[model samples]
Target: MRPLIGLDQVSVAFPGTLALDRVSLQVFPGDVLAVIGANGSGKTTLLTTLTGLRAPTGGTVVDADGPVRLRGPADALTRGVALVPQEPQLATSLPVWENLLIGHGGLRGAAPGRAARARARALVAEALPHVDPGTPAGQLRKADRAIVALLRAQSSRPKVLALDEPTAVLGDRGVEIVAEATSRLRAEGGAVVLVSHRLRDIVRLATRVAVLVDGRLVHDAPIGEVSVEELVETMAAGRPASAQVTARVTGERPSGGSAVPRAREHRLSVEVLAVRGLREHGLSVDELTVRAGEIVGLAGLAGSGRSRLCRLVAGASGGSAPVTFLGGPLPSDTRASRRAGIAYLPEDRANESVFAGLTVARNLEIADVVPAGLGTLFGPRPDRSRTARTISEFGIKTASHQTEITALSGGNQQRAVLARVLAHQPRLLVADEPTQGVDRTGRAAIHTMIRRFAESGGAVLVVSSEFEELQELADSLHVIRDGRVVARRPPDCEYRELVALATGARDEKEAEQ
Candidate 1:
């Protein structure tokens, strides 16, 4: 087949980073290309460039027949391209029908009347047979959100579909759904480019795999030629040394009765929060606790009140408050929660965390603006040296502390956010979807940071819709569904059990209703 899309000597340069450097690649009809890379490896930047959301500083992008003036996402869409961003945003007030139509080209201009309605029904049936067409898209789970997005994009019958982290928010079943969808798309002769950290998706859907390293394309080959471990190592090597070594030396503890004795002392104690009749869109909690040195994982489908609970605890949400920290109930305000040493890392990093135009040093210091030496804001104005050290320690890759945050890659931006919160050393850390946009190396670094926090007698309340993430990170797991915690289990909760709880499979109709 002739190439559907091609990049020749493409390069993208920001103030302090070269996001893509002299890169060349091709996409063909019926191809599923998995783009793999470390955090700062430019996967997103490359996608943006392909979709015409960005202009290359050098080289050219040829689409279908010839070189074209890449204008915007709309232009790319009209030319047979669509991108499902890392954090797919949807209009909360819109119904599933409207949301899907939004992708088709807004509600007003979309195909109208009974024929349009028939087409919408047909499109939904083809893409998501299980989703309720009349239901609100906001009411859908994160996995469903991804599925709906895919459906919306595919509804246009684009020649190429760009899905970024499509399964990042999904469960095992959701992953299977995406895999099946990819297979169907390929069968229909449409090319799919999937960017993801999950190895399973790549293995299942990709015919070819390409790995990027620090703005350069390092590995481009057939999927059958590489193993997951080899891919991981290449991506890891591409990362800065700090990110690679952050999780260094696990299982190196002294073996003896002292190690045995330490296990008993590792128990975490969670303070009781006001757990009375709390209700928000069907999610309710009777009681919850967060113990120091323990990782509490909240697992559920999207809109399961997992994120809402985090917001309530962080004092960011407008809800009835009985949430507590350190034996005292958390105040019904955000500042009070922060004052009590609870740091929340939001799922939407770009929107919720980091002040974009500021310097990296200043951004890192925002979490806790404490004076190092003189203990005065006016005197020496917060230690730049300490901020730089924190940046290095957290394995963030930046040109310098003075570099603009917007210039760094998504993974690096995430790393900088981690450095910011971890520097504060909060007694209780509430991280909501911490690894959403991060690569393997960055994920490992974040995992290490969370573990170290727990080891150092701090509490961690992690709310993740990704079942796999909860399974790997939580010392204990709780399943939230319909806005309430429906179940709890030990850290090593069986994946089946976690899924069962998340989907409310075992719960009676009364409980779910």
Candidate 2:
């Protein structure tokens, strides 16, 4: 079978770094090639070069027998290649079907005709009926939006399709939807390039696999030849021997200590997170206590007032409440909350968390940017050596301290962000969806890290929609519904019980009054 797209000794260089080194690779018709690697492994650069986003600084891109060229995205599309990014952008104001066919199948300088709309509707119905064709893009759930993006890309019927961490952020159902769509494309004679760190995806979807380590394609093998353990070891150790690969990324603090160093090390009990009139935001509960060294979880549906409760406890409140920290009234402002040994992790990491476009080392210094005593405005220049040590201390794998934080994998990014948050040495951490989107190993590591924080005499208040995660990580869970605390359960509560409490128990009189 002939290759649909090929890279012959392609090298791409950015300032101060060679993103891709004389890497030769190919995608054949009907192929599903899974790309696996640690962060900064140049997987993304490979995809960009393949899709014409980055020009190769050396060698050539080829087709079957000779050199091939791509002028831009339009040119790549014409040459049978398309890229679906990690977070697919859509025209939020438009209807789902219109968003799917927005930029394609239209007259030059005119809107998409009715036949195009009809075609998009039919295609979605036949292939992905789960996605509502007429719903506004802004209103669709995260998974539905992703499905729509996949359908839109396939709408063009390209010979070779490249996906960058497509299922990284999706749950089981979302992953299944994407995997099925990919299978359909492969069975229909199209080639697919899947970049993912999720081991299950590689095992279940890829026909073959390749591993990239430090900008080089180090391992290429048939999916049947590699065990999951071998793949993990290979990615973690580059060329594996007998060492435990899981230790490298599995939530061991860079500065190693016993797992429960100071078991249940409580400094003091903070009482009564009471906010007068917070009932306006569905915050019906007036009080809860989070003693130091405890992991207290807030579980509920998206609009269940958990966020409001978290914001109140984390000091993002508009007005001061009776909430006490270390036996004193907690401050109302975010800055004061930080100074008072509290840190808040926002739900949206892409926009609210990490400092984008900054190097890993610089992003680590963000917590210190808080102004204190009118002496330092952005903290000290951050001892360059100390920041570097912090990265090692967190086991954040990056090619260099100078590398952009965004270049790291989703897991590493979470670690870096958590490291930054911990920089404050806060007594309490208000974490929202602490392990979202990370691979299973990464997920476990993050959980361990959070648990370690609590074990070290720091308290944690976790807000999550992932009931399973709460079950695994929380010491105790508070279920919220319509802004009221309906049930409090142990960490091992039944899944149905938590779901029923959070979503069922609607009648106010029937709940905890």
Candidate 3:
């Protein structure tokens, strides 16, 4: 079949970098073609080119029948190509129904009209059962808002659907919904291009896979022919056996005592702030704590409130949760929590975390921009040259401290961010989804840092969706369900048992209780 979408030697350039370099790609009618690549590998640029938001510096982006010239986002939608961008900007002030309609050339039907109401309900039911059509979009959760945007796209039933990191904010069930929706679109003869870093989703849903690295097409093949590890190796430019080993060795600090010396070893310790009830999904945690020099892992499937719980402990949320540090209550704000020596690493680096436009130095120094007591009006105090040295000590590779944070590789960026947090030498670190989207080497480095933190009588609460991660790093595990801590296990907990708890699988022992 003729390709429904094609890119012939396409290239896109920014002021300082070539985003897409003489790259070519194609998608057949009804094909689920996934574009896989590392961060800054031009996946987004290629999608923008195909959707017409960006003009190619060279070659062309053809929609089988004709070229799609560079225009704005609206022009691309008008041409039957709808892009669900990674960050789905929504009109929060509007109702869910209105938001959906606004994306479809404004609301044609009145909100109270019978047909319009029914159509809106149908749209929500089909794409997002969790969202209320009558509710204002602003009141919805971030994930739910993303779902609404997706539904709006499907409502159009366009000839081509392009979703960039659609599952980034979704829970496990939400991921399934997106996968199912993409599959359904294929059945209707629509062309689909999915850009993602998750190999499992790509392998399961993609009919064909295209790998891009450094703005070049490195591999294009049937999904069945490639393994995720192989893809990782390709992205790294080779499958060297000792790559992980080298990273682990270099990342390791030293052996003062623990098996993984230099690994921060924290027994579970509690650092509370001003939070009451602290509820999001369903679980209610009242007075939580882990001893210092302990590794405590909170394991749950997405939507279990694991991420939210971590955020609360990190003092990111606005509401007050009565938190205690040591024996005394902490101040109700983040600044107070930090003053009490609490640090946090958030899960959503692209949104909730990350100051993208800042330089590596600036990003790392945000917490210390004005250390308390430097001056009430803000005056310089101690030199941060030591802090800069510590950043280098963490093995953060960059052209310079002034390098744009966005310019670093995903691993390096994460390390820089971590360095900033570590510079404070926090007594308690709450890491939420710390390794998501990082490479094997990056994961090792982060794990090493966390372990090292725990070793020095610090406390840690690690919440992760990946079971293997928790398994490798946690000395104790807490299973959370519907917003409650339902079970706890030693660090050597059985993987199957953990999985069963995460998925709500039960046996006779639980039934008897």
Candidate 4:
């Protein structure tokens, strides 16, 4: 089969970094090519090069029909190519319908009229059955935002579609929708380029797989020819074994009695945090508890109330739920939550967690300000020694602490954010989608940190869309559906069983059997 698009020895260079070096790949009609690699292995750059967002410094991009030079995203769109970025670029303040329509409008030469608006509504109805088109984009959950971005891309009916981590934040139903859409596109002779960290997604959607190490394409094969273990080994080639941190179940007591003992140990294991009669965003929980020295995981599909529960517990949003921390009543406010030793790691790190315009040193110092009140009244200065230790401990890769947080990769940024939150050493950690964009190595580091914290006697309540992740990291998993936790399973529960429960494919009774 002739390739719809081909890259011939393409190379892209920045001032000090060689982003892509002599990389070549082909996208054929009706083919789904999966791109797999470690973070910063030029996967994003490859997509940008194909979409004309980044001009190749060397080599040519050839079309089966003729020679082609993509000037920019606009040019690529004209040639029937579309890209769905990892971070959604929607105008949050605008209505969902407007964002979807505007995305489609950019591809068409003619301005959208009343007829076009009607067509867009029909498309939205067909593509997104659960989403409300009239709702503001800001009001939608992160997973919903991703869905909107994908549906908008589908609206253009491009011959070639490129998706970056589309299933990273989506639930099982959302993944099914995307898979169906991809199959339809393939049947219609369109090509797909998928970049994802989830092996299950790769197994379900990809016909072929390409592995990139550093800046080179190290392996390429049909999906049927390679096992998941082989793919993991290929991606972990350069990453050291020590760098991959696994969760540990320790037997020794925490130093300095830092962790409160669990009730099973003959001592009263007090609940560090508790919520009762909580209600928000149409989701309600009768009661929830996080005991000291425990890691409790919330597992559910996207938009299934996990994020909302995190926000409510963190006091980032208003809810009628009565929350208590360490025997004290808690208020519905962020500052109070922190003052009460509750630390929150938001899901949308780009917008809610990090200070992108500031340096890593400054971002870390924000933790210091939380405890000192006005002690550093003149000007807040970061503790250099503490920052250096944190950078090393968290395995955050940066030129220096002075480097801008924005300049780091997704995994590094996540590490930095996590480091800052842990610096405070709060009693209760409320983390949502903690490893959403991190790669395999980075994920291990994060898992290590969370486990260490729990072992130290601190309590953790984590929410993750990946059932396997929860199974590995959590001591117990809570399955949520339609805004309520319907089942609680041991960490040894099966992934497919958990998914079935979360999606209402099976009832709790059936799951138990």
Q: How does each model score on lDDT?
A: 0.71, 0.73, 0.70, 0.77
- lDDT score of residue 303 within candidate 4: 47
Best by lDDT: 4
| Residue 311 alpha-carbon offset, candidate 1, angstroms | 5.7
Per-model clash counts, in order, read 8, 2, 35, 1
Give candidate 2 misplaced runs (Cα > 4 Å).
106-111, 125-132, 238-340, 343-513
Writing each residue's lDDT as its tens digit, candidate 4 over 1-513 gives: 777876889988875567788988889998889987654578888988988898899988877875589999988888888999977888899878777677455545567788867776676667667777777889888778888888778878889999987876566675697788799899899989988756667878899999887778888888999977677667656543321112223333333222222222211287998877766555667677888888889987654678878888787874243777887777568877887788899999999998989998888888877676765657566779989999999989999899999999888899899888888789999999998877666777787788778877789999886666676678778887767777888776555456556645566576553
Q: What residue runs in model 1 are displaced by over 4 Å at the alpha carbon? A: 103-110, 125-132, 238-324, 327-336, 343-513
Q: Give the TM-score comparing model 2 with the true structure, all chains together.
A: 0.55
User: Model 4: residues >4 Å from true position, as ranges?
Assistant: 9-22, 37-45, 54-62, 65-71, 86-88, 91-110, 128-148, 167-176, 212-216, 227-313, 317-331, 344-425, 429-513
lDDT of 2: 0.73
**What lDDT tens digits, residue by residue, belong to model 1 across residues 1-513?**
677776888999986568899999888987889997644578888888988889999999887687876888888888888887767677757777667667464445755567766777777666668877777778887767777777777767778888887776665565676677778778888888888755656887799999887789888898999987577666655223221112222332222201111222455554523354565434577666777777788876554568878888777874355555566666566666666577778888888897988988888876655324335555345677898788878888899888999888777888888778777678878899888766666676777777777788888888764555565567667777656687777654445455445544456343342
Listed per candidate, the RMSD to the true structure in angstroms reads 10.0, 11.5, 8.3, 8.1
> What TM-score against the true fold does each predicted structure earn?
0.58, 0.55, 0.59, 0.59
How does candidate 4 fare on TM-score?
A: 0.59
lDDT of 2 by residue, 241-347 (tens): 21121222243332232222222445555532333334543357655667777888888754456777777778787445455666677777888887777888877
lDDT of 3 by residue, 439-499 (tens): 7677778877887777767777888766546756776677765566667765444554554
